[model samples]
Target: MWSANAIKSRREALSLTLTDLAQRLDVTKSYLSYIESGKRAPTPEQAVLLGK
Candidate 1:
């Protein structure tokens, strides 16, 4: 489960801005923001990709 906090902190720890992470995931920055804010969720495949 990708909790919003975990997603946010991990990105910060990696020094990655939302736009950078979103591009890596092939999603829009707005969509990534939605995920980080708990307004949306990533699919299982996306979850797996997050590990890479």
Candidate 2:
């Protein structure tokens, strides 16, 4: 299972703002927030994109 904490940590390590990562993921900031908060999971395609 994916860890929301890990994703947030990596994004911070990369110095990416929520808006920045949201743009890269082509998702809304709220949606990304939900992902990072463990309230929601990315779709399979989104997961692939995130993996890149």
**Could you tell me every candidate's TM-score relative to the true structure?**
0.93, 0.90
The lDDT of each candidate is 0.92, 0.89
Count of backbone collisions in candidate 2? 0
Q: Output the number of the lDDT-best candidate.
A: 1
Q: For model 2, what is the error of residue 36's alpha carbon versus the real structure, in angstroms, after optimal superposition?
A: 0.2
RMSD of each: 0.7, 0.9
Top candidate, metric TM-score: 1
Q: How big is the positional error of residue 1 in model 2, measured in Å on the Cα after superposition?
A: 3.5
Please give the TM-score that candidate 2 achieves against the real structure: 0.90
The parts of candidate 1 lying over 4 Å away from their true place are none
lDDT of 1 by residue, 1-52 (tens): 8898899999999999999999988999999999999999988888997877
In candidate 2, what are the lDDT values of residues 5-24, reduced to their tens digit? Answer: 98898889999999999999
Error of 2 at 15 (Å): 0.4
Clashes of each: 0, 0
